[model samples]
Target: MVGRLVIVTGGESGIGAACAQAFGAERARVAVYYHSDKDGADRTADAVVRAGGEAMTVQADVDDEASVDHAFTTVEQRWGVADVLVNSAGLNMSGVTVREMTLAQWQRLLDTDLTGAFLTSRRFLNGRGDRTGDAAILHISSIHAYAVRAGGADYCAAKGGLSNLVETLAIEEAPRGIRVNAIEPGMILTPMNAKAQEDPVYRRTLEQNIPMGRAGHASEVADLAVFLASDQARYITGARIVIDGGLSLMQALGA
Candidate 1:
């Protein structure tokens, strides 16, 4: 992966930051894209550089087509074209039930989670043009894509759609040598789970539900992301790998 141009969305924090640093460890050139947290993005980019990789920070709203295109264009002008796209930009589930969810709320989550994936993936493909070989697109999805949480209708729906999107893109791009896949993580102790990261009492309560007896760390997921984007996973496409410590497996246990 040395010198490979890689684009990481949501590079400001969490899984995205871990992924940026992990790829940097492989000596890949990384474009860290942030929404608003410029400081966090810069910190992540610095970590990438420290890990023996080239790094640049770009401001992008993954949901906006213009912004996505501009961000990719900036990288393309610097480098030729990106070799990989790691879409980690997304919003957590709004704890509103279907009955209570407004149209705006539904659109907002979908815009960032599902629609953003589409925009970035499409822009990546557009930037590639006729060039294709060993390229990959990885989406950081959730186990809720199938687990169906009561108050996560918006989030669950978006991830559910992302599953189809990944599969469809995999088939469409396979002949072109571009692999696409989804990483459905259960419980990772990122900023998204700030409470769990700060409180062992609360964290243990959730971990008890996971068969592995603990929540996963961001680096663990980042390792898997690195593998998926590597040539080692060349045959792995159109598949969604779960890294939730078996938490989703217990969905039907109490029933």
Candidate 2:
């Protein structure tokens, strides 16, 4: 990945931050895109530089078309075209039942998780503008995409839609040498799982459900992301790779 231009959205924290650093360790030029987290973005950028890669911070609201466009445009103006895009900006499950979910709550999650993917991907291809070679686009999706959850209608639906979008993009852009894929994780120890990260007893209860007997770490997911975006995974596209520590495998238990 030396000298490669990489863009990682939601790079301010969690799996996104870990991915930025991982790519940096490979000496990739990383653009850390964040939303309303200047301080966090700066910290990630510093870490990227420390890891032996060029780093830049760009603010963007993934759900908004203009914001996504501007963010990509900024990166392009500074560094010709991005060689990779890691769309990790998203929202967690609302934990509200479908019957109780309001229109606002549903729309908000869809806009961020689903529409965000569409907007960023479209802009990324547009930025390339007929020039393409070995570029990759990775969406940090969730096992919830297929393994449904009772209280996660908003998040689950968005991820489910993302699965189709990834497949569609893979076919649409395969001729351009752009590979699109989804990384579906479960119970990763990120800010999105703050309660589990903070409360050991509570976490243990959940971890017991996982065959691995533990929750996953952001770096673990980041490692997979790097691989999928690398030449090693050149032939891999439209694939949904699961890194869930066997949790999703047990979804049908007791049924």
Candidate 3:
């Protein structure tokens, strides 16, 4: 990945930050995009530099088209078109039953989790213009896309849609040499699972359901992102790789 340009949305924290640093370790120029955490973005960019890669932090509200465009413009002006795009900016399930969920609540999640991916992917492709050699788009979806939950209607629906989006984009862009794929993680120990990270007992309770008996780490996911972005995964596209320690496999157990 030496000299490759990469863009990681939500690079301010969690899996996104880890992915940025991982790419940086490969000597890639990383564009760290954050919606609200400028400080976190700065820290991520610094980590990239420390990892021996160039980086810049750009503010981008993925749900907003203008913001997405501006962010892409900034990256292009600073470092040229990105060779890799990681869409990791997303919100956790609202945990509200569909009956009680407000429209605003549902739309908020969809806007960021689904529409945001579309906007960023579009902007990234637009920046690519006609040159698409060795470019890849990675969407950080979730096992919930298929493993349904009682109070995750919004989140699940958005992710399910993202799966289709990735596949469709992969088919449409394959001729242009662009790859599109999704990373579906389950029970990851990111800030999204703050309760698990703060309380070991609670974390253990959840981990019991995972065949691997542990929650996944941001770095672990980042490693996978690095592999997917590398030439090692040149032939992989429209694939939904799961890094959840087999948690999704257990969802139907005891039923």
lDDT of each: 0.96, 0.95, 0.95
List runs of model 1 lying over 4 Å from the truth. Answer: none
Which clashing pairs does model 2 show? none
Which portions of model 3 show Cα errors greater than 4 Å? none
For model 2, how does the per-residue alpha-carbon lDDT over 1-255 read when each residue is reduced to its tens digit? 999999999999999999999999999999999999999999999999999999999999999999998999899889879989999999999998999999999999999999999999999998888986899999999999999989999999999999999999999999999999999999999999999999999999999999999999999999999999999999999999999889999977887
| Each candidate: RMSD | 0.7, 0.7, 0.6
lDDT of 3 by residue, 61-159 (tens): 999999999999998988888899999999999998999999999999999999999999999998899885889999999999999999999999999
Candidate 1 per-residue lDDT, tens place, 87-148, comes to: 99999998989999999999999999999999999999989998868899999999999989
TM-score of 3: 0.99
- Model 2 poorest ten-residue lDDT run: 124-133
TM-score of 1: 0.99
Cα error, candidate 3, residue 157 (Å): 0.3
Candidate 2: regions farther than 4 A off:
none
**Candidate 2, residue 201: CA error in Å?**
0.3
**TM-score of each candidate structure, all chains considered together:** 0.99, 0.99, 0.99
